[model samples]
Target: MMKMKRIALSALLSLGLTACGPMEESEPMPESMFEEQGSQALDAACTSLGTGITSHACVHSGNPADHLARTASATRVTSAPSISTKHTAYDIALPSGAEGSVTYVPATTGSYAFYRTQNVPFTVINGSTSATVPSALSQTVSSSGCLLVYVSVHDLTAGTTYIVATGPASGNAITVVPEFLDDSRTRYYRDADGDGYGSTTSIYTACTPPAGYTTQRFDCNDTVGSGASINPGATEVCGNGIDDNCDGSQC
Candidate 1:
């Protein structure tokens, strides 16, 4: 009986040991993982800009239209023939010491009038009022079978500005568009979970931020609860395993 009791005790000990298996080791996250995620998030954000628009970082000092139009000659082209016109606004980022260009492709092959307007505040070019083109603001026009308008970044201020291009009425459909010459060093933060907050370490520097990203970087846990409590001054819930205040601590 004693031997049988000892055997039963040993069996129980073995079963207990089996139940308490070895702890599984967690895999370490790769260092480049954050960077890769950030890039993907940024791509999504920029893709949302739709067609003919781009994202970049540059300085727009002020509305050049205010000064440009104010200084523009008031002599209107009275009795000018109004033709069916197509208008396009180009958003260009002109970094200091750089240049930008826009291509104007006319739908038809005929003499087309080209007009440009600077991105100015409170100025809307609805293809109604026609202002005389200023010689100072005239872009260097080039012909490669199509018209290419080039503007120097050195002449632009730091911020967002606009350039309006108007094509001739008699030609093929004219498309005015802005082109990015180079990459911008603008910083954007990754918000992989679509939370308003972004990860501090997961940062991207480009002219535009990708989808699931933002210009702001203040998220404590980008992957937690769809970015719950990721904003500044967020409440820290005790024992929830989340950094609500982005302070790297959970209550």
Candidate 2:
């Protein structure tokens, strides 16, 4: 009986040793292999990005000095209009048909406008002493209370010009700012009833209008009926209780 027990114990010990041998051999995968696979994946991803990779860096592996050098070499791009020293603003007082002169020397040839703060009727002459105003480049009053007198000056040289108020004398001051093509100025009006059209009373000037406001000032009545015809273009309904056309007369 003792010999049989010893044989069973020895068999159990051999099975345990075999299991442990396989467990020891089955070690975790090497960390280097995982790192190599990750690198390959990153490379494939960057390659798949295609043309976008050219405009952007794949990885910011550059040192601080290298980053600083690249930032220093980069140039700033701006969309704002560039005005030369030749462009200027003038506050001039003029009676009706009287003229005021200012020196304007354009650095680059482009379309320019004499933007006035008030709706002052003015005719612009190329020279200060020239009696004849150019018929082609005539002055016009904009709806935004500013006179946008456009003048196309090609290969503009340094010179002075005269701005004369054409209408009867108001004895009011006018500010003239020489604006290049595509000025950012915009005029907004009050839209009390949330209608697209705005009233002529309130005037707001900015590059962009606020909410519930519009750039058009054609609303005859902002306090008209809810969802009613407050637009000036609407047909006037005669004798109706509601002012459908907002023309102050009911049909």
Q: Pick the candidate with the highest TM-score.
A: 1
Error of 1 at 226 (Å): 6.1
- TM-score for candidate 2, please give it: 0.27
Best by lDDT: 2
Question: For each candidate, what TM-score against the reference?
Answer: 0.31, 0.27
RMSD, one per candidate, in order? 19.2, 27.7
Off by over 4 Å in 2: 1-89, 95-97, 118-121, 128-169, 182-251
Q: Report residue 237 deviation for candidate 2 (angstroms).
A: 48
Which 10 consecutive positions of candidate 1 have the poorest summed lDDT?
Answer: 66-75
lDDT of each: 0.36, 0.41
Residues 1-251 of candidate 1 have per-residue lDDT tens digits of 99999999999999999999856655434445533442111232232221111221111112222111111111122222222223333333322222222222223322122222232211112223333223222233333332333331211112212233232212212222322312223445677766666666453343234567676666766775667556655777888876768777777
